[model samples]
Target: MSTSQTEGLLQQLLQEATVVARLSGQAIISFAWLWPIRGVLYTLLHPHVILSVSRTLFTSLLTSAIIFTVLAFFTYLPQAAFLSIFTGPLGPILALLLVGAESVFLVTFFARALFLEPALSQVFDTTLVSRGQNSLVRDGKTKYASSTKKEGIEGALVRPFQALSRDGLMKYLLSLPLNFVPVIGTVAFLFINGQRGGPGWHTRYFQLKGWDSARRKRFIESRKAEYTAFGMATMLFTFIPLVGLVFSFTNTVGAALWAADIEARENLIESPRANAPNSPKTNEGDVRAKAE
Candidate 1:
């Protein structure tokens, strides 16, 4: 290529990179960052959350510790080595942290299966009530609730699932290699996962509101930055091994709080119509559909 042409290409690439970096910075600086702190404070203020989750606390930690030990034994050295290729002296320490994070992530499947899921649902509902949205389950309708086909809405605002599916875990595994490139790699890993996870928390909300896929997509697209911010904050808070256990509930509270706020604002604009809840209805098909 000619010298001028190459220079032009290089300048264009640099501009794109700068734009991406600026957007990333904005995403990280949102009110969503405070959600984790809100979660922590909410946990302390509401013993109900702690009580509900405490049933499996010992089992969850012990199980996580065991899984962490075994996985670190087999994978630590290799992971550290991979990280060291790009991180050099800091690699081992970062690898140790990542392994711990992975162990915690893996054990969530068991923890959720045994107790965490229901506890989170309870926490979400409790937070919703506290935030003045009690009508979420009452006669099944309120000005603050979605006016769509929520007749089938039940339980919490989110459907239950393990941390990530095996396929998602494999994708996460693939992303881990990004850690080889130091700070940028780690940010990429977190950002990618956070992006998906942020919105996943609201499938039930979307369905409860009776939003079709297109409307839901537009709503999410408009707030993509904030959602990613929430997700990234959630990932970081939950990445801390044993501490993740508590953060999990707090994060749910935070998301519920956010959702409540959204509904509240929308309710102001919406006419004061009410729809009753289909309290007995189940949401297997639509929930999964919206989530996908």
Candidate 2:
């Protein structure tokens, strides 16, 4: 590898390391919510947690495999000569100059799919269930709350491979060599993103979960400083190598959980009146009080 390539590899490796550590940290914090074992065992063996990590890894492999196969065939194409312009230093440099097309595309797309879609579904479902329970489940005594592809392509197989597909790839592509900058800000931004995407993904989820714009905005404002601090730790971890890569995946999930917890706390803080037991009127009164 040339100097640039070597540096790129080191940066990439560090990015992966911190990503994993950040994920692990998030997971630990999530389990902490359950108290004692609820937090401990869930952190270790949660199926969704494991599946999320596996999915991230698999996505990386699939995208890479697709890119490689295409690149191999493209080199033989007659038009391939024109694409060589991207191979030299100028290509990556030019890529760096672009204001992160990859980040904008991947983060928005994946965040929408992973968090928003499901959240909307849940919201609708909860609404319907709540309505239904009012009528059916409780026989008018309780309120029923109830609620209820594409593609195309052509390419040197690899020409398309160069396309951005995921948040990781986007962040990776966006920062480019700028990540090697000696200044604290640039490097810090690059490293933290590896973990930031994860929490960011979750923030979207909370927003979808009935967190109105004002409430969501307030939570983000309150937590922004802490998130930045936590991200610094994540940046350092992602630089560790094999271990770091694993942590990166964990970091994404952990960050999401951490953000959710913060929002949860905020919600509780904003409304201190808890529902009283026994009489339905007490529950109704509590709800009224909460709204007030």
Number of the top candidate by lDDT? 1
lDDT, each prediction:
0.64, 0.38
lDDT by residue (tens digit), candidate 1, 1-292: 4677556645643453454355587686666767767877877887675565576555655665677778788998998898788789889877876886686567656665666665666667677666666555343434225543455444334532222555445445556655666777777766666665677666556644656779989998888778777877787776665455556767877877777777666654442332235334424432222222
Residue 222 CA error for candidate 2 (Å)? 1.9
Error of 1 at 283 (Å): 28
lDDT of 2 at 187: 47
After TM-score superposition, what is the CA distance of residue 234 in candidate 2 from its true location, in Å? 5.5
lDDT of candidate 1 vs native? 0.64
Model 2 alpha-carbon drift over 4 Å, by segment:
1-43, 52-57, 61-175, 182-186, 191-199, 230-249, 263-272, 275-292
